[model samples]
Target: MSTSRFSSYQPFFFALVLAFGVFIGVMLGPIMGSKPTPTQARSTYTRMDSILAYIDNRYVDSINTDSLLDVMITNYLNDPATIDSFFKFLDPHSNYIHKEDLQGFNEDLEGNFDGIGIEFNILNDTILVVTALSGGPSEKLGIQSGDQIIRIDDTLVAGIGVTNQQVMSMLRGKKGTVVEVDIKRRGENELIPFRITRDVIPVHSVDVAYMIDDITGYIKVNKFSANTPYEFADAVIKLNSRGMKQLILDLRSNPGGYLQGAVSLADQFIPGKELIVYTEGRAVGRTEERSGKAGLFEQGKLIVLVNEGSASASEILAGALQDNHRATIVGRRSFGKGLVQEVYPLPDTSAVRLTIARYYTPSGKSIQRSYANGTDAYYDEYMQIVMNGDADSVNGRKA
Candidate 1:
């Protein structure tokens, strides 16, 4: 009888063990069978596996798409003109900067660079020196304006297919470096060769700042760059020390730069906690920037000058002061680039500047004209205005 009971309980014990095994499998199934992460999956394939497979399976006589595509992309990105067209497709102000161009871009924003310091223009395939920047290495070495670069070092560059890029590359260099150039002066029988030691050249956004009279001062901002606000502040302090009680801030033809610089500059004039500018986009929520910090010349009579060439951060500063009635806005209509751009650097050191937001004035005015007609048509709007006799108007109305 006991042996029979034991045999019957054996089936029950087997059933219990099976049930526990199934439950444990169900609990740990996801952890055991989960997909591997991207890093782990990449370990399974060698770097050249795809390229090798394409080479082996491709039926064409000769078509290296893998390497060809890389070369095409690199070439397109390297060419500034081509990359400019790519960005201009979306908007007028959007831009791309290759690694080679980053140095110049940084120098522009920083408002300083090490170079021989002469602005030149390639007119009729000849490099014409427009101006030997005052107090620069070139100017110090007696290099004058209207001089032509006939040769650079040993290369005969005159009348060659020498581009502006080549000329700049040959001239600009590290501090204490020397660049030898042959200048063709007017009425000179022979070319003049001079070795110019490169030095720090200041790129001034505040082109000129001085007291016009006892109480009146003038400051011209060529562009709103990273160093603009500090330069402006210093200029204002100097003017104030000279008994400047009224100020004229000129922004005519200013293309604009770092928005923070504009904000800081506007803050120097606008008083209290008033709204300066606001930005919003599809992915980004509405953000409002207000004026703070004790303004340097808040109590003085402020006049801001803007024109059709003034854009981006220029519009922001002007709009802020105009909306608050803090300053008198003079000159023609602004360029109206209310779009904000954010730059993202790629792994290869190249960068893409993308329009991420639309900024508005404190009074909820956009001032962004229109980009619906495409980039070409959009830029041509200025020509249309000029032809229509509307460009001469002040405050965007008939003069």
Candidate 2:
């Protein structure tokens, strides 16, 4: 299931998906707490009995209903073009990212990929930069944080229906490739054209790590991604080398990644037997992850920072640390996405990342946000609030 070359980086993009809100579907449904033992397997035999018996004993047609259903399902997902077309007819938020589209989608999730490395928000037909990586082509070419991206190559980037994917498709390519982009800065009306060479950029998981002061080392981690635990270990070692006796871990914007990755990272700071988080759903019974082995930094004064974006794996780490009193958590309430999503690869190279169940912090607080009004409305309610208050985020969420 770990799709990358490096085992350490296996959890890389999994956590970032939760932030894009697309993972509401990707990280989408029910947990079976109990695994199917031999007896359970025997119990499952009856599930297919009626259908198999019908195929063998009754039915008017060829009686290949089960096989026919399997073929239909396979063919449906194998056709990416048809799926994309189908998505075009659906709500804008309901998107279908093909295997090819997956790369670009992942790029958006991690904040970096093979490209110019700039985050842009479409505004009034103008592609405006939300932020630019300092070493990226956009930054190298003097593209400021708020610069307007007017055109990519010869294509004008502004206008209705311009998607985030289109911008990347135009700008991203194999290394050494060059793409022409025109910019309209806020201070000037003149359009400035710059040629940007595409390159492989490393997406960072450690958002902020610095000395809180002389003795306290503070590191804000967005998620437990591929190489996260190892990275945390290395960071800890480096800080220890620098004579840090206390640590502050910040998981403010994290949306969660691999459950194992969170576990691995949490293991570095927790010791003895302790419940991090537990899951239960319609199909599954109860599953709990207990701390194993002593953490490497168990002797330090530790604190964790959290906020609304924190969920899932983030909650696991926070909950585990808090449950055991391994660290102190300070911040606003987390997003409460305590459900788990398991990724299953289909025959077509496509996948179904389905939510398994409701995960709980040790104190039994459900980290899953209220999504009862259907997924679409549930997802867009935030934007609706912002719009209603004329771009006031706090006011809208407060409303």
User: Per-residue lDDT tens digits of candidate 1, residues 1-399?
Assistant: 123433655786686456444433432345324444446436542333333333434546665545554575478656768767756646665788777656676666775777888766565577767556656888888886567789888998888888655777888889998889999987899999999898888877787899888999999887677788888999999998999999999988677888898899889988899999999875676898888899899999999998887888999999999999999999988888888888889778978887777889998998787876777888677656443433221111000
| RMSD in Å for all candidates | 17.8, 14.7
lDDT tens readout by residue for model 2, 1-399: 111222433354354333333312211212122333446545543433333333433456655544654565478646766665543322222345455545554544344467776765565566666556546677677876567677777777677567656666777788888888888765686888888888876555675567877899988675566767767877888788888999988887566776877888777887777677788765677888777876778788998888765767887888888877888889878666666665556566555455546677778877666654545565466545323432211110000
Please report, in order, the local distance difference test score of every candidate based on alpha carbons: 0.74, 0.63
Off by over 4 Å in 1: 1-85, 118-165, 176-197, 376-399
| TM-score of candidate 2 on Cα atoms, chains taken together | 0.66
- As a TM-score, model 1 comes out at 0.66
Name the lDDT value of residue 197 in candidate 1: 90
Each model's backbone clash number: 0, 16
